[model samples]
Target: MLLADSPPPELQTLTRGQYDLVEYALAGAGFALLAYALYSWTSRSEVGVRYRPAVMLGLCVGAVAALSYLLLFLRWGAGYDLTDAGYVPTDQARLALSPRYVDWSVTVPLLTAELLAVCSLAGARARKLRASTMTAAFLMILTGHLGAQVVGEGRDTTALVLWGLVSTAFYGYLYVALIGAVRSSIPTIGREAAVSLRNAAIVLLATFGVYPLVYAVPVFVDVTAAWLTAIQLAYSAADVLAKVGFGVLVHKVAKLRTAEDVAAGVDTHPEAVWVSNVEHSRAVLPPAQPPAMATSPTTPTA
Candidate 1:
């Protein structure tokens, strides 16, 4: 069967009303988690320009993915009456445009822009890896954006070609950039690596674990399919949970890194360090001596 000919077995049988409820539940859960993560990051105020933008971009992509899924499968899904007209072309178009396309346009570009900005800033500081990182990020964002357009739009020939091109680029950049960062982090690479890798893993797991149900929908039993849809919704909710959880982790790790710097007497804040250094230097220096006078002349005259 053509991928589009039949609704995925997972999504096929649910009543529109039921799906709406599921969508709402998922959206609320996902948004909450994402928001919490952002808040946690904001609280730290220790975020470097590079990591700060990267974090926000990651959050944006994750959150948008969740939102798009909810709107496509639930809100718009409700427009089709199960007993009457099922999913329609217009519905598909709406789904494609509002959430999916929007996500595509926004997520990748925002990520790329932030990465470029960060990389540029880091480059100014002479970080050797900045150029490569910026390049990778830019390419990934471009590809992810293209893939989204294809899936959302459903124009087969063009969509397939575009998706293949962009997805490949995205994956390539993703691997290179990540591996490079990991290698650079060194000694503690495994621990630091978890931050970005774990998040990506969470997103992939969520996507695969949740999205295929629509494929299974046509073949499965209606009640069973509904249950699976419900399960998928839960999985999406878990995505948000992971984000917030990771956010908390990021915030804590940042704190620990900061504390370590302080304990080791390595000052990360240049301004503060400069001021302290100046004060210390002033305290240590001896007071200036008065200039000597020609005392011999005065004695002779007396």
Candidate 2:
């Protein structure tokens, strides 16, 4: 049946306009940053010629990841029937209420980007790291997709059983890959501890800080309007946090592109000899300091 045909729920809810305004605004900002990063990377990329496929794959995955979320919203909006007894909420309502679609959409693109990033890293000489990254990316997508599917659809035992198996496997992979990535990416005690601590803190906050205030109160608050509003608000807040985090992550990745260029330049130029030697001894090379210029007496120093 068409979305318009869906039964109306008893709830007199806000219009789509009411719901999506913030999402659209944040998404716009997110896209703008992505565009800038892509442009910057393309312009500065030295090995651009070699990693064209990887880049394209990353973009494609990114698009897919984005589509996943869009699909969720579309499904959520479509699922609800606001006029019906149970609120024959269109799929869109279902999507929003469930959170699966958003999860899948977000995770898929991230996984794709990550896989491509791993490939790029491998291309740049982090062979072990690349392998680990790819494995982790794949598992994240797999489990994330399964979890999303399970949550989005209505109750079905067989479907759950089948998807549950897939989910389990994927989750297992996620654990293994995450461990591997961390182990390979950071070689120092302090750095590893810091990274671990930071991630743990973020997860802790998401669970303890933002979740209860915005989400949990609704169930106990015992007013339908209050509950829905609280839930929606919670989701909106989460979305904002996610976009902000992703924007920062992408920016960091963009910075890495510059680092990669510097690395590539060193490899091709005469200075690589020293850097390469340093990498072998300490497993840490000095930051790729830009070529120090000979300041001539008459040259205007910027």
Candidate 3:
């Protein structure tokens, strides 16, 4: 097993390649999420009003996260002075984390909203669940940010740990509430929506699990170049999954639900019937149009 001796950033002797890994991770996440956000925005017309909130939340989360990553990438580039020997940290190094907090603060609340949007709740129940989870998500991110600030300021580790614990309580609430809501909603929804929503929950559980581990890194290990590289990579990848990946899955659930509704003869968006055709084909449901329509000769007019 490799042990981190915990060399401070200035003394770490970080090579250009190692430095590039961190920079590229931030930039890659930014661009990918921005693209996803645009895709979500354009796809708005494809889903019905019932599930549109889910898609909209995805767009908002992806957009905010993309901007945050852009800031992080630029901040990372500016924070390092590339010398022949290695990369050295500048005064701007600490500023990189600010964008990270900003990303979390906005995206976290929005994530819960999207999750609720796909659930099978309604009326006051829906409103109540949304409020509770969104509040928890916001507090979770806020306390986590405060804890990180405590750590960054070289304050008492006890206070840092305390904040971490408090943040963790909110995190636990968010995780449990999200998972519970998703699981409960699964049995009540259509087949395609259920599967995608279940998958989204699984992905949510996975990506949510990754964050605190990354957040806890500084507490246990020395943030050497290797550790920082790992942290950047882990956090960036997690953000992509939790934001972009989650968005895609949420959209898929909403899309499939729209398909089910349209298949059931409900009036919806103009493109909904075609979207249903495609999704129903994938789900092995009854074909919206006969296969003969594509290959067979046209029937004579009446």
Candidate 4:
């Protein structure tokens, strides 16, 4: 395993100090984010029931992200060193698994479903879209996780590169389905809500793109204290932006959709008749015109 041995004597003190500093800072930030998400969830009484699930899912995303960071912080704080292979404990503790990948295994699928649920139309189309998006998301994350595991297991670099390409392809498919296919259906919610959903997708795709770059850093640079620090910090920042920031945008879209429903005198109850009948629910708008399919050859290329 790379970095299985101690650092060179000249760098030992600096490495230890930097590790402690970064770990503590990340732990504190994780707790703070978790607290904020819980607070937001507790204060969600005013949100309409029809929109409540999406809001709750957003909070779930935040909570999962916080847990990932906290786990990493704890591992480092316990004297586990970040090696190219994985985390190695300095003492008698067992080897620590990668919390970030575990976090993604849970959160990525939920995130995909949340985004789709928020912008969903009130009919069969919604069901189909949600299922497809969720499946693609799961594939994307699974491939990425498997690739990382292969690399950590000392598999050939060629295997890692092939897996990376496979994962990237899956990710591309998800972007096409989410941003391309879903964008056409957003108008069923409301104009303002549609705008919000589009913006949210853009932000999420942009932030999520950073993960691959951070993951690839170790492949190019030697696994040193500074390299590990950069990986942790970059990933932490991406998590904050993708999960927490995207959650805020989702909340905004839900709020706007709820307001539109209220203005149109449409019941916002989860079991309301209009909730399942897209035609009736969207009656406030002009006679239903089929939304033009908007396909982008590239969409910020998530």
Q: Pick the candidate with the highest lDDT.
A: 3
> How many clashing residue pairs, candidate 2?
31
lDDT of each: 0.44, 0.40, 0.77, 0.66
Winner by TM-score = 3
Pairwise lDDT winner, candidates 2 and 3: 3
Q: Could you tell which candidate, 1 or 4, scores higher by lDDT?
A: 4
Over 125-144, each residue of candidate 1 has an lDDT whose tens digit, in order, gives: 42444445455545643554
Q: RMSD to the native, candidate 2?
A: 12.3
Task: Quote each prediction's TM-score.
Answer: 0.52, 0.45, 0.85, 0.75
lDDT of 2 by residue, 209-278 (tens): 3432432232223334334544555554554343334333333333333334445453222122122123
Better of 1 and 3 by TM-score: 3
How are the candidates ranked when ordered by TM-score, highest leading?
3, 4, 1, 2
The TM-score obtained by model 4 is: 0.75
- Backbone clashes under 3 angstroms, per model: 10, 31, 0, 0
Q: Which ranges of candidate 1 are over 4 A from the true structure? A: 1-13, 16-21, 46-93, 96-98, 108-152, 155-162, 188-242, 268-302
What's the residue-level lDDT of 294 in candidate 1?
56
| lDDT tens readout by residue for model 3, 209-249 | 88778767666655677766877888889888988888888
Q: Residue 160 deviation, candidate 1, in Å?
A: 2.5
Off by over 4 Å in 4: 1-14, 80-97, 151-155, 189-191, 219-223, 268-302
